[model samples]
Target: MRIKYSIPIVFFVALVIIEKENNIISRVSDKLALKQTPQTPVQSSRSANTLPKRNVSVTSQGKLSSAFMLMKRRLEDYSDYQPAAAVTTRRKNILLLATTRTGSSFVGEFFNQQGDNMFYLFEPLWHVEKMLTLETGGTNATAAAKAYRDVLQKLFLCDFSLLESFIDPLPVDHVTASLFRRGSSSSLCGEAVCSPFVKGVFERYHCGNRRCGPLNLTMASETCLEKEHRAIKSVRVRQLEMLRPLAEDPRLDVKFIQLVRDPRAVLASRMVAFAAKYKNWKQWATDTDVPIDDDEVKKLKSNCNSIRMSAEMGLRRPEWLRGRYMLVRYEDVARFPMRKAAEMYKFTGIPFTPQVKAWILKSTQASKEAGGIYSTQKNSTEQVEKWRFKLPFKIAQVVQKVCGPTLKLFGYKFVTSEEMLTDKSISLIEDIL
Candidate 1:
């Protein structure tokens, strides 16, 4: 009975061994078949190129392990995929270079009213003049020039923090106060991203309080980097050479708008405004006894020379300017604000939208009704010729003599003695004043 049971068990063990050997052979045969299979060109080359190189040892592993390795390789390839081409967005940087009282304030105000997307700074470099005092020559002037350019570079990059080293809002002078007010209203300091310090000062100042208090309103570098358009209006810079470095920087997309006004008109406007402030021309004149005309004539000559020098530089560097520089006359802008504004927007890469048009119309209308204190708000054809009448016939002749070359270059025609007398009858500057 023991021998019969042992014989049955041996047969059962042999059968189990045979079944196990058969299963091993079947798996080996399947793997060999897969290895020997012909692959299409795409599967053999393209897939191999895209996928990470497989280890021969990994391929020799069991099917489950090999399948998992293939999946992981595919995911790695997908994560590493990058397009050969890319699209990038570049911001527009604009510099408005002009002399003081040349209607730059009005132009800057127009840009400022464009709402959030536009970052407009009015006379940002005025602080340099205030700190260094342009009247002092030598090292102070040299230092101020360098500082001016440095400030411009930082401002263009949207790094307002650099300004704090030189500018302080607590002093409450016109320059400081204006900068503080402008900074407070800037869309760059919107509630979402504004620092606690800026928010506090803004709130306090908005409540009709003049004091700015202790405020740290410098913008983060990233905030400035994200701005769509950045613009600076400067009367402090007299030469284009001062800005050439900024224009040539490959990283910055810079365009320049050179604002020019008739020298006679500018002189007349300056004298009248000065006379009004001091109650007489003597207070502001270099020589108190000198007639207003003589004092203004000397100024006109100096101012015209500076303007001509800048214009001559532009002429010499025509290729450098190309599409980068635009010349806009105050007369043209004043006479046809909407039309000129559209052209300006096009040059600066700013869209001439309905909103901008509406603002222009509203602002120009208000300016006509209520002339501003420092600058005229009136945007009318009559505004241009008002200077002809405001300057006395003798003074106008003197200005034409001193500034004739610049006047001709800018296309400003001289008014005949008869025309000057006729315009003097209808002059509105005195009336408006």
Candidate 2:
């Protein structure tokens, strides 16, 4: 009787061990989901390469390093820490390098959908890593590089074990109960996820904490690899400032997708967006801390010009860089997404799966309506030419004067004839910007 009871007890003990191991492995897998899978040794290797590097100065480096160290130290104190993993290893680091107001959001979505195994961080470091000028309080290059790397680790790594140890312990459901759940109108996590403050914290956690890991690292890696055995892809939407260094990284299989749009249309849409959110452009600029003369429309036009210049500069850099780059017009994406998407997939070396097609259709419809790239509903495609109708003639003339040179370079031809405005008033930037 003693021998029989011992055998039953042994079987129960084995089951408990198996369950514990499974739980740990699942957590490990979640962390790995942050990185792209490693490619074959032969395919991953690269030759020596160089491109135009950002002229980040020594002074800038010192400041950037200090900023990052501060952020990192604070990161060490956070409770829910997770580290990024190799699964977040993107096969090719893709930069949706474009100006604002181009259909980049949709393009980013398309790229995200293509790599079922790929991890995406939408405009992850734009706020902290935006290109700084000496005029903008001077920049520290080293600190900037470190900060950018921190963002990369946060986005790619899932090993947050160290960060986890730093948290100030609270009840298990404290965050959910006291903060997320109470104020939320609905039980859905979307409300909590969408909160600007909450979203900022989680995004920092998902990107920085090496231990916290991806949404489904284990499932994504095991399932995606077992099924396709393809390289992991990562898409990061970034403005011109951040693209300069990324364009030159040899270890990264970088591909740049540039989205160009009519500046007039962009100005009109931005003004409308600002007005809806604030009382006027001056108030909007003030609230956001954008450096510009309160009443000068040229400040806005100058900003627009700078944006175009940045895009053009990034798109042109690949000519010298070893990686691949492609230029895309937002209008084409809005009008003929499926046709263009096929080309884009071919360029990225990812197959345009059926699911990708469906996502494209949904995204295109949403972009058409919002007069912006990131929208959930279908709006109007006519917004491509909206500048003509929305901007007062005088304001439009000022924009034309300021951005005219840049616009012409981008293929926009201004309409000089007032009488032929309706028929011949084709945007000089219709083709490129």
Evaluated with TM-score, which candidate comes out highest? Answer: 1
Candidate 1: where is the Cα deviation over 4 Å? Answer: 1-89, 134-142, 169-215, 220-223, 276-299, 367-371, 418-421, 424-433
Give per-residue CA lDDT, model 2, range 198-241, as digits (tens): 33233223322122221322232233333221221222232344
- Against the true structure, what is each candidate's TM-score? 0.65, 0.52
Worst 10 residues of 1 by lDDT: 38-47
Summed over model 1, clashes come to 0
Candidate 1 local lDDT, 307-371, one digit each (tens): 65556445333445545666677877876788877767766667666777787787666645575
lDDT of 2 at 218: 29
Deviation from native of the Cα of residue 98 in model 1, angstroms: 1.2
lDDT against the true structure, each candidate: 0.58, 0.44
